[model samples]
Target chain A: MENHLKNLRAEKGWSQSDLAEQLDVSRQTVNSLERGKYDPSLPLAFKIARVFALPIEEIFVEEAEDKK
Target chain B: MSERIKSAGKRYRLEFGAAMTFYMVVLFGAKFLADGVEPGAWLTTLAIAPVVPIVFACIAFFRYYGSLDERERRLMSDAAALSLVIGIFTALTLGFLKSFGVFHFEWDMLWFGPFLIALWGIVRCALLLKR
Candidate 1:
């Protein structure tokens, strides 16, 4: 799954470590999420959405949905 | 202040200490404590002492597994599963070879625990490298 997590974090001026600290996860997890190598669980998705004050769907996009 | 003390790594460090205590005692006990043992009762007791710490290790590992995050737990589960699978096959082949007169060695239960630990460590490293 592709996500706007990197862009969102960028807009907030947060590095991967900064985002990981905010989310209480490892920086490696944040890096993987940014590179689309790992998908966050629903609860983690909600946390990320809450951190950015955005809807979950607005942050994550399925490949087909993104292309459309 | 690092919060890694609460991590699975710290949990396993304690577990490793427990395991090593059992391992060293059993592995070397028969050599050093070979004297002053009388008859079958004490011999049997000495032979079974290793099992006590092994049980503690199993409980420690169970707690460690339960405490891991999803990704780390998945990786650990995969490593353990692969370790068991590979350990079984290795034992089977070696046992068969020994039975067939192709190999001659006194392979006993004493070696089994250490073998599994070695294999599990190797499998975990291999899995991590693949990732």
Candidate 2:
């Protein structure tokens, strides 16, 4: 899944560590998510979306390959 | 904060230190006391040393249950699996060497082998967590 997490976090002036701290996860997890190397679980995705006050759909986009 | 990670790392270090100290004390103490004694005496202590750490680690794991989230658990499981595979291969190779008289059998190998295996496994797991 592609996400606007990096963009949203940037707009809020929050670093990866800051977002990780707020999400109660390791900074590496946040980094991996931003880099698209790892996909967050549903609950974690919800948490991220909630943090940015955006809907999950707006924050995460499912690619055509992901559908297959 | 970073403090929490530091604290967890410190606690892990302390636990590992204590385990190693206990392992060495039991191992050396048995060897010292068993001077000219039967082989069973030293063997018993050697067998007990590795088990001690596993029990302590289990206790620590249960005590800190909620602290580890899903991602941490997955990393740990993967690491443990990798460690088991490596350990089995090492055991088989060592066994083959011993049977062929290529390597002499020693009591220390039993303790050191598992210790290194577990240490390497945990380190690998921690690295995977970062990815």
Candidate 3:
């Protein structure tokens, strides 16, 4: 899944570690999320959405939508 | 990392260390006692004494595993699954070879634990590196 996590973090001036802290996850997880190498679980996706104050759909685009 | 995860890691280390320390002590003590005894129930009891600590170590490992995040847990599960699959195939192949007189060596059952663990570590490291 492609997500706007990197761009959103950048906009908030938060480093990966800072975002990881907010998400209560490891920095490596944050890095993997940004790199699109790993997808978040439902609860984690909700947490990320909450942290960014955005809906999950806004942050994470569906693969079909992304391909379009 | 989260404080919860950090504390989990610390607890795992402490528990695993304590268990392994006890295992070493019990193993050596059992070996020493067995040397002075004949083949009997007493000797058999001495031989399995180290298993108590090994059980504790396994408990510690499972508890630690429960505390990991989803991705980490997935990776660990994958590593363990792969290790078991590979280990079983290898063991079966070796057994067949031995039966066919193509292989000749005294393979101890005790060595399988460390072999599986080493394979798990190697597979886990490879998965991590691939990410």
Instruction: Indicate which candidate wins on lDDT.
Output: 3
Lowest lDDT 10-mer window, candidate 2 chain B? B61-70
DockQ of every model listed? 0.30, 0.38, 0.66
Best model number under TM-score: 3
What DockQ class does candidate 2 belong to?
Answer: acceptable
Clashing pairs in 1: none
* Per-prediction CA RMSD (Å): 3.4, 4.3, 1.3
Name the DockQ score for candidate 1: 0.30
What pairs collide in candidate 2? none
- Candidate 3 structure quality by residue, lDDT tens digits, B7-98: 89999999999999999999999999898798999999998899999999999999999988888988899999999999999999999999
Candidate 2 lDDT over B26-91, as tens digits, reads 667766766666668566775565567667765665544345555665666667677777777877
Question: Candidate 3, which segments miss by more than 4 Å at Cα?
Answer: none
Q: Put down candidate 1 lDDT per residue, B33-55, tens digits, no spaces.
A: 65777768777777677677778
Candidate that beats the other on DockQ, 1 or 3, i.e. the better one: 3
Better of 1 and 2 by lDDT: 1
